[model samples]
Target: MIKKITIFLLLVALAAAAGYGYVTKQVEQYIAQPLNIEQEQIFTLKSGTGFNRVLSQLTEKGIIVGSDFSKLVRRFHPELTQLKAGTYLLEPNTTLAQTLELLKSGKEHQFAITFVEGSTFKEWRQALETAEYLEHEMSGLSEAEIAQKLGLEHDKLEGLMLAETYHYTFGTSDLDILKRASSKLQAILDEQWQQRQEDLPLKTPYEALILASIIEKETAVEEERERVASVFVNRLNKRMRLQTDPTVIYGMGDKYDGNIRKKDLRTPTPYNTYTIFGLPPTPIAMPGEASIAAALNPEASNYLYFVASGKGGHVFSKSLAEHNRAVRAYLKQLRSNQ
Candidate 1:
């Protein structure tokens, strides 16, 4: 009789084990199955949002099916009360397991914005302010305040950031982007300074940066960067004024219309290269790597002047007469076009 009772207990245990195995298999299949989503979509998990809310949202959106999903999740991860919050791009046919793992990973979708090489600091700020995803922290802060936050010794804020497209997740601050760009600029400036050509007229890396900003504004042509750098470098070496029109317009600030008149050049400001005998007190625009490198390592040329070639380039010359001739041709072309 005892043996029969033992046999009955063994049968009960076997039945229980089989049932558990079947349930485990079902749960595994359920997790491995793809969701009912037909197309790609973006889902946001806001900060402090719980996992239950996330699950409810997903289910309501028809991204997930089956009423047992929540129960299965609870069975599998009862302790998982919350998901890391951020924007997520959900692809079609993504499995439940994949989605869960993605949420758990916490890496959000990254967005990109490019700061053009010759763009002003104000333009850069505008770009950040208008960007869709970036958090705008500097909207109310003055340039001086921003400079202080960046730990820049100079009160002025122009030309401090590096021009590059930076990728960041949503909830990222504009100041955060600026800080990264600033750090990048400092590193590049230091590295390029170490490799600068000998006898460069630049007194320091900051001087090189000022020259680089001018070079960046001077030409968009890649081949002309060194030539443009040479003109300014030679001018500096010979104590000739840079006489670049961009600086004149920059100095005019809000008063500058589309055209730069003779008076604007004659009107003196700290930034007007036409009036100033040396580099501007501060850079006028952000410079790129090529321009910065050209500033540090100028072409070995005695050419001291450049005029627009009327074909989207410049005509470099060693004498004022040649520059004058090029300027006359540019003016004539401008008149003919008009």
Candidate 2:
């Protein structure tokens, strides 16, 4: 009786081991399947969030098929401890293994550091100081040195970098960042220059950029960019000076103290269009993509000038006489409203 009981117990133990192995294989197979679909989704995990909380959130969001499966896999693999907290965009059909790999590698998502249209060099300098990718502070880089490093003929890079988000790899150099941005801007300029409207007064691509920079400063509204571009285009066609206040501000540089006095316009500098008959020697601020496009393809209008309408946009005119009248009306309106 004892021998029979011993044999029976041994058989039961073998059967239990076989069942466990089979169940473990099935669980592994289930966890390895792709969790993502065709659509892209953004997931953010805050610091100090527990693994179970993350799993629950993913499960709720339908990214994970089963919370239990994810939990099991995570428990089995303790090496995935390098996951950093940040926003992640999971592309379609990403496998669980791939996601696990991403977390394990601790690759933080890359984001663009945007330099908005019409931002001055001072603003650009501050932005660079804040961004994590730049090793040297903005103060360390002079315009001439940065230009030399980026292969630019002009010393100023503020208005030339082109406002856009650029993807950066880990450990990207400042020179490389400048190179990529400048290259994109160059391409846009070339394309626009080639397809430029007939009889346009733009002498060169640099001249076009200068005009674009002015247009960028003139308006923030998308609809108004073309109209604003038309005003400058008309002025250029008629050989009139682009007496933009921003140009005077650029020329004033450090002396501009939050106020544009009557004397500031008289102060002659390279960027002062009032002093210079043509476009400035360089751009005053970085132009966005739309501004560049608008500069190249200005609206066909008789508008030769514009002034702030005090409505967050510009009021355009076909001639100086009309422009002066509009300016008077707008300024009066502005004073009354204030």
Question: Each candidate's root-mean-square deviation in Å?
Answer: 3.9, 7.6
Q: What Cα-based lDDT does every candidate model obtain?
A: 0.86, 0.76
Error of 1 at 304 (Å): 1.6
Regions of model 1 farther than 4 Å from truth: 1-41, 46-49, 61-69, 76-83, 92-97, 335-338
lDDT per residue (tens digit) for residues 1-338 in model 1 = 99999999999999999987877777677667787877877788888877767777888887876555465665766544446888887888789778877888887888899999989988998888899777888988999999998898878877888998999987888999999999999999999999999988888899988999999998999999998999998889889999998898788888987998888888999999888799999888999999999999889898988888788888888898987998899999889889
Q: What is the lDDT for 285 in model 1?
A: 95
Which predicted model would earn the best lDDT? Answer: 1
lDDT of 2 by residue, 197-278 (tens): 8777788888888888888887889999888888888877778888889899888888889899887787788888887888
Residue 315 displacement (Å), model 2: 2.3
